[model samples]
Target: MFRILFFLIIVVSAVEIALFVWLGNVFNVWFVLFGIILTGLLGALLAKQQGLGTMNRARLELSRGRAPAEKILDGLAILIGSVLLFTPGFVTDTIGFLLLIPQTRKPVKLYIKKVLLEKIRNGSIKVFRHY
Candidate 1:
């Protein structure tokens, strides 16, 4: 995981530098800067909206004496999406938007659950959290 993250960082930096140079050549540097700012603002607003909706759903489920596990997953997806959207890139934004949408998030959540269960069943997901 660490190695993958390190590689991703290097790749992302290279891509960002290339994008900056390309955009600088094709359009005003100031416009690219504004675009980055705009995307950040949009991402923040979307995150806030999604977070509140997830919280509300969770609260409603709790009030009905039901487990709100799915709501928690949605909240987590929103957080990840927010982080991705805040990243300056078309690739990140595309991925972030997918995670933010309910239809897309559902499959992603299910996939995550399946992977976690598999790890647990294989005894690879050891309990590390302290109570």
Candidate 2:
């Protein structure tokens, strides 16, 4: 997993740099910089709003004595979206925005949940308790 993640990071960084250079040449360095900043700011705000909404739903569920499992998944997606949005890359920001949007977030959350459950069943993931 670490190796896969490291490879992904390297690939993403290279792609981001390539995009930056291409855009800078087509427009201007300042324009590219502005785009990066704008995306980060807007993405952060969207993620935050979605996250708060998810949290509220979770609280409402709890008040009704129900488990907020789906809301928790939404929160996880929002958290990941927030991180990706702040990562400074067009691809990441686009993906981050998708995750932040409830319409798109459901698929992403389902994928994550599926993977996690598979890992748990296969013993690739484990839970530990502290005393």
Candidate 3:
């Protein structure tokens, strides 16, 4: 798994470098800079909106005496979106947007839950505190 992950990282880096070169030649450095800035602004706006919505939903769930599972999922999505948004690339931006959008988060949340459950079942998941 580590080997596969390393290889994927290398491949993604190479692809991003190639894209950067291509875009720089086709358009300009300023265009790339503008794109990065635009994505950053858009991501910030979306994060704020999603965060408030999640908080509201969590409050409502608590009022109804239900667990805030949806809020947890929303929080995870927000974190992933933020990380992706910070990464430089249109691909990451697209992924970030998908994670930020509530409609797109359901399937991703389900997939993450399935993976986590499998890890727990296989005893690959562990808990540790550094405090």
Candidate 4:
């Protein structure tokens, strides 16, 4: 896992640098820089707004005496999306925005739930009760 993560980091960095250089040459350095900054700022703002909504839903679920399982998963996705948006890369920013969109998140959330359920069924996920 560590090896794969490290490799991915290296690849992402290389791709980002290559893209920066290409964009810089095509549209000037300042334009490229401004675009990167604008995307990051926009994505951050969107993530923040969505995060607040997700929290409210979670709180409402808890108030209704039910576990906010879906909200928790949404929160996790939002967190990851926020982090991706914060990262200085076009690919990450695109993925981050997708996760930030409620409409797009529905399918992703369903996939996450399905995978988690499968893990539980296979005994790959361990659950512990704390008293």
lDDT of candidate 4 at residue 71, scale 0 to 100: 90
In the range 13-127, model 1's lDDT, one tens digit per residue, is 7887788778878998887888778878887888888889899999999999998988988988999999999988766777788888888889999998999889998999985
Worst 10 residues of 1 by lDDT: 89-98
- What is every candidate's alpha-carbon RMSD to the true fold? 3.0, 2.7, 4.1, 1.7
Worst 10 residues of 4 by lDDT: 89-98
lDDT of 2 by residue, 1-131 (tens): 99999999999999999999999999999999999999998997898789889999999999999989999999988998899999998999998999999999989888989999999999999968787
lDDT of 2 at 28: 100
Which tens-of-lDDT digit does each residue in 20-123 have in candidate 4? 89988998999888988999989878988999999999999999999999899889889988999899888888888888888888899999999998998999
In model 1, state the lDDT of residue 46: 80
lDDT of 3 by residue, 9-106 (tens): 78877887788788989999999889988998899899888888898999999999998986988898898898888888877788899999988988
Ranking by lDDT: 2, 4, 3, 1
C-alpha lDDT of all candidate models, in order: 0.87, 0.92, 0.87, 0.90
Q: How many pairs of residues in model 2 come into backbone collision?
A: 0
Model 1: what TM-score?
Answer: 0.84
Output the better candidate (1/4) by lDDT. Answer: 4
- Off-target runs (Cα >4 Å) in candidate 1 are 126-131
Tell me how far candidate 1 lies from the true structure as C-alpha RMSD in angstroms.
Answer: 3.0
* 103 Cα displacement, candidate 1 (Å): 2.8
